[model samples]
Target: MTPHPAPQSRGVALFDLDGTLVDTTYLHTLAWWQALRRHGHTVPMVRIHRAIGMGSDRLLDAVLGPDRETGEDEALSDAHGTLYATWYDSLQPFEGAAALLRATAARGWRVVLASSASEEEVAAVRARLDADDVIDAATSSADADATKPAPDLVRAALDTVGAEPEEAVFVGDAVWDVEAAARAGVPCVGLLTGGTTRRELEDAGAVLVHDDPLDLLRHIDAGPLARPPAPGGTS
Candidate 1:
């Protein structure tokens, strides 16, 4: 009988959709701010911006305090969603976001978008990304029991691609992303496009930081998404 070759090992590239790829950080911040105001809460935009990457519930907890009346949580989230939806048609992906996904796919990595956005929101943003050809899979808020800073979403994304933590790399633009990836046992690459400082992302456990998707693409070989060495070959 002829010998059979082993199956190829492929690494997974997990990416965050909002802010990391699409330029919706400020839009989210504004939406949340307006929602909070409508709910009689007056949180600062700076604080809301920093909390943009968190799930709606966590974001409310972080901004409105855990002691806040639970009765208004759902309403507040709905308000934000309504306000945010207004800009759906105008959403734009950061420069080189599609190229980065393509390049990573070309390098034999399975690219998966790990986003906390709802399915409808993910669809809208994916349309803006226009990189579905290279994306192997994508996870929405429904895929996980929890969200960023909790690791459930990251783990869900990993599961979607049948990837183990050690065989995956996550890329995002927030400290929450780094924290989530850390809890999921995957190294993360942070981007500055979402208004997060590099120091904050580094402190949260990002292995590397870049200015944005374009910057990361420019130095892809030097980051976590670099092609893995072949069997019995040097890196």
Candidate 2:
């Protein structure tokens, strides 16, 4: 069960970007792999995908481990930014993702995007989602002191929307996202739209798991996301 209030409830909806919205986890993994290989580290895609939700700095360290010493977190980030920027024009929103956000926004929930992507990448995705008017605000790793699996990013997003923990819900695909949202005191709605398995997402802290965005949209009302009808009418 989602601990946070429903969509019509007085709260903000904080969302994770990469896999949750844009379906680009594998792309991110490949991009990081290319970046690492350019610097002489040959990491497998399978390992890199699991770490896709983490920011580039953390992903590099996670992939490269603590053994290799390099001060190029900035350089690698720059390379990724340059490479990933090219995909913005081609990025596609996941099924029902835009509608879900819009519906929640219409229902009185303030929508905010919380991502672990770089500033450049987050901007690209925002452009792709093009939900600027509907989205109350957005938070990226650039806006946070730490990355996902840490509560800072979620806290920043909540602050941006000016919503308290009890007044919000976080939706995401990764286990780290679950942990982060948990630390921030928000319920996590897990969607298996990304590459991760349902069992993994459920075990991570997802009270309700759905097949994808469309599945979630269909069940929003009865699934604990439907708040009491709004003031004038039902949301």
lDDT for each residue of candidate 2 in 119-220, tens digit (9 for 90 to 100): 667878878877776777777776887887889889888887556777778899988888899999888998886788889988888878888788888889
Residue runs of model 2 more than 4 Å from their true location after superposition = 1-9, 228-235
Highest lDDT: which candidate?
Answer: 1
Candidate 1: residue 121 Cα off by (Å): 0.8
- Determine the C-alpha RMSD for candidate 2 after optimal superposition of all C-alphas: 4.9
What is the alpha-carbon lDDT for the whole of candidate 1?
0.87
Evaluate residue 157 in candidate 2 and report its C-alpha lDDT on the 0 to 100 scale: 85
TM-score of each: 0.93, 0.90
